[model samples]
Target: MTSTFLGMPTTAPRGVGHLRGDQSFPAAARRALADSQLRRNLGHATATIRAKSAAVIAEAPDWQQLRDAGAAIKADVMARLPELLEQLEAAVTAAGGTVHWAADAVEANRIVTELVAATGSDRVIKVKSMATQEIGLNEALEAAGITPVETDLAELIVQLGDDRPSHILVPAIHRNRAEIREIFLREMPGVDPALTDDPVALAAAARRYLRQTFLHTPVAVSGANFAVAETGTLVVVESEGNGRMCLTLPETLITVMGVEKVVPTWRDLEVFLQLLPRASTGERMNPYTSMWTGVSPGDGPQQVHLVLLDNGRSAVLADEVGRQALHCIRCSACLNVCPVYERTGGHAYGSVYPGPIGAVLSPQLTGVEENASLPYASSLCGACYDACPVKINIPELLVHLRAAHVTAQRRPTTESIAMAAAAYTMDHPALYAAAQRAARLTRLAGRRGRGLPPPLSGWTIGRDLPQPPPQTFREWWAER
Candidate 1:
């Protein structure tokens, strides 16, 4: 099921989104865990979201059936992605809209920048869009001397603070009220000086700041929750009305969406609309759900452009076991219940996509070697699988990606050598007995409940190694 772009294999695309540094997840997690404030913020936010999701999900008696349907629909979309995307492009064009295919993040950004430049506007308002973030579109726009304004409240907070989003549904979940207030005061040009940390006040201040941009911005960019292949309709679901304003107020509207976001038909939207709100914001229905079929006369944006972004998605779909990661609907339920994500937060994952989904998705999309450590970021508790509305087996994918990482290594690592040695020793009964005897002798030299020497010492830093028993299990068996 290898996906191809322009006749080239897409398993590993160049210049797709990835972490900036060589630092691995363990290093990042260590630093993040040390931040008490971050831990508190993540803990509180995830706890609240988890509780709300649980409550609403309980109200839906057929939630599992809905989940199954969502998974099936996504699977169908992935299976026929190439065909559906063609259908979608034709539909959008027939409806007087243009569609562009971007094989990677670099191409997507270039297309978007060029499109904005064509409009002769140096600024564009943006609805909260993970696709844009994944491509670093705001930075790209700024590099080209264009300003990109974020209109969503949480996205606005993250943008103003010059921080990366730590959660999917709530981008600024890492920032508390007081932190948000400080960012608003320091960064916002015309914010009230006497602003407080009250949620309503924060909302009002953000609204006041974004109102002018929403009213006057000539262009808007967005990401789709789902794109219906049958009607060429792009859907954006949000709690705030900002997405609506962005979709309608602008004369030229551009949407950047992952190719995986497409569904086969309008009927498929029903399952996702029901699944998304509950799994994400814990609401029965989103406060606003906007859908537009290409260009509309005198109603919304006259010029509609859609950039169907691959950016390693086709590569992700290439994997049989890991392809299920594409079924994700950007619901952050996996984050809410994930023990590792709650403790270390999203920055540790070092991608736009975070939490348990990120753990599997990032590595597979970018090549497991690039994000090798991400596969090991989870505790394999399977909470993510349980929480996912689309039932992506995130834990299984994590392990599969890890094996991919190991298989791709050109040289044998220390862990690999150790594993190989242990395998050989266990294969021979005499050698196994000798190894056990040797381990017991080493136990006599080392103190009980003490850290082991180098390599092994790293594992025992936080806990002591247990002393080996005097008699080997083989010796006990012989006595019996």
Candidate 2:
């Protein structure tokens, strides 16, 4: 028997990875909006992170310069991505690490599964990895009769609950203390019967459970935050020590990273290290910063392998305007400050990468026609752009992607016809004034603060339309 989501395969497809629900943004958002608990969880979590990020960012006087340097470094990386990736591959290989190139998700999963099989271990420990999630690696591993344990505390909570991540920095942000306590007691092995919802108790319980797995697991999988092309060093910036443990404890380590994660030099890495921590966790520096350059003789993992994934990234890089999105370091600052995301949450976007960044990236990765509503998910308030550390102009990109969606429509839509009609009317003064007179006659049939009918009703559902003025502004001006 195979599990599925909305009749589509649960695992990611061959080329571009698919969104979870397969439902459009509007449809999923309607469902998300009804979950009052989710709304409260997102609102509280986002507010706290937003405040923390702002305070720490204010402390750095050269923060803007750092942001500029980060953006410039990323831009240069993109410009020379092919060359840098080759350099990275050679460097990793020279450092005694094997490099594998996966053109798509299926290939990446196959390569990773085969590698784990060769190790003769059916169990592997994982560091927190968005790349693995994006490719649906856990499901793939499970199909091959291997168990991948999530070592990160939030990831462990999400795994135990059988839930998808709702936030970037905090995957289980949707679950409160009480909910987490229930998940731990129910799913975790050897959990105390009297476990409470207290934070310290939950941490202790999780630590004990994961400690056993960490010691036993012979294989570990991870994702890189940034891979330095110049030195072949892979960096994982984390708040918890789980990443460090996973990177060092296992005999074999396999890291799956997106192609866009590579930077040109170690100096370029310095700018991002400063930008990422403050933007993500609001700390001047992350608690654990793990770096490994391939294999070490008697130290960390003896067998190290890196899979470079290009699932929809090359396509995204081809677009001039859209490629700016690749500049994202995944700090998720935009998610913390978005008004729509606060209310609707990450699941509404239907992709692993959600919030404002998802709105732009998803549509471009999967054609705008497929995820048309995602681009319109925002209020265009420009909050995302303001909060972005790399200065991605998200609002401008949203409009651009929306235009692409309109262009892809096979036939003209009702909204398009209406907009065209209004444009034509406004262009001709005689027609505009005559239309205003016609609208004024509706004052007799219409009542103040009443809902409109049909096409206009949808707008009025949330807000009432004002009655048309008795006389036009032009008419009043002429009388004066």
Candidate 3:
């Protein structure tokens, strides 16, 4: 159980998960912005997704109504999360599946590792799961002497290259086909030596490599898109059929999902299925939508285990304004439309989650002090709010988190001190007029196109300040 006082989470200490970054957002973004190739990759990919999403979303006559319904459903679920979770546990248990509760990432990782060990397997095949990634499960498994193989093509590319995922839907979005070809040749053990940068050739090579592992791996791990409380059903929506294969082929399966993923009824699930695919892949519906309850007589994995993860979610739910971030369906729509994200790329945000949602969510989950710069990463453009199928109002959330960060600071910053001086000057007419007259002296400095000095230089580096007018409006009026 996590508690919040004065808008701060007191539950878990930081540094356990992937939410905090090694460097502040500005420092990381500077490096990413300098990489012209990375910008080209992101620009081309995001543009395509945005165009496709707009076309498909336009086809739905009831899109706004659906968004309303989805928002309402999420609001209800958040309000009654504890009760719904208990109901979900009971239903899953009744259907012969085991349920486990994990307070944080460490506990969840230990539970999944022990389950894999009990199966007596040294290797496991995996479905692409953000929840598992959030917990750094693959790294944890390797530390325990077990190997985890990623089955998704994008995830496989990331794994082979030993690179971090830059986009939520497309982990390797930062890499183009040529880079992927190079990675396959260098790292994929059985890859064809003649593999080309052609998409078809690259995909076939990966499929051939993963075929045997899919057939023989005794254990599989996944993350659910939604869990139905009424029927104890778990759902996974994916563009590729790999998730379906992992769900069925393995003898034992373990699923780790965020506690916020549970919806009270099947009716609520209906809204998201229609919303997720269109917003994410720009498809009318996912190519593969896998749903299962507990276990079937011999149909799927015999042993099913569901680990409901908290990992600061309870703390997020404690804050009224910040909790809406949990409504994210992992759709990259916000990313596609975010100017800051499209330009700087996801690696700059320094979290498993990125974009406008990440700017707000990561700070709240890890506490504002740990991820302080994230809140200021956005330009407050409202495109993300418009693109969100669940209507998260991401721009508003960014502002809210920024205020939280400023409030959390123990000392007054230079910006705060400057603001205070400006406020004081504005309150008195004589001081304000004197300050205006003193400002005209800057034109002398501006003759050579010089920028403000020291504290104000950072703002002027990317922009040009106009020369002050020869006379103020007040001065002109007085002369008349």
Best by lDDT: 3
Q: Residue-wise lDDT of candidate 2 within 75-99, one digit each (tens)?
A: 8888999999999999999999999
Ranking by TM-score: 3, 1, 2
Top candidate, metric TM-score: 3
The lDDT per prediction is 0.89, 0.87, 0.90
- Extract clashing residue pairs from model 3: none
Error of 3 at 24 (Å): 0.4
Off by over 4 Å in 2: 1-20, 438-452, 456-471
Cα RMSD to native, each candidate? 2.8, 4.7, 2.4
Residue 164 lDDT in model 3?
92
Candidate 3's C-alpha runs over 4 A off are: 1-12, 443-450, 461-470
Clashes (candidate 2): 0
Model 1 accuracy (lDDT, Cα): 0.89
lDDT by residue for model 1 (321-364), tens: 88999998998899999999999999988887888998888887
The collision pairs in model 2 are none
Query: What ranking of all candidate models by lDDT puts the best one first?
Result: 3, 1, 2
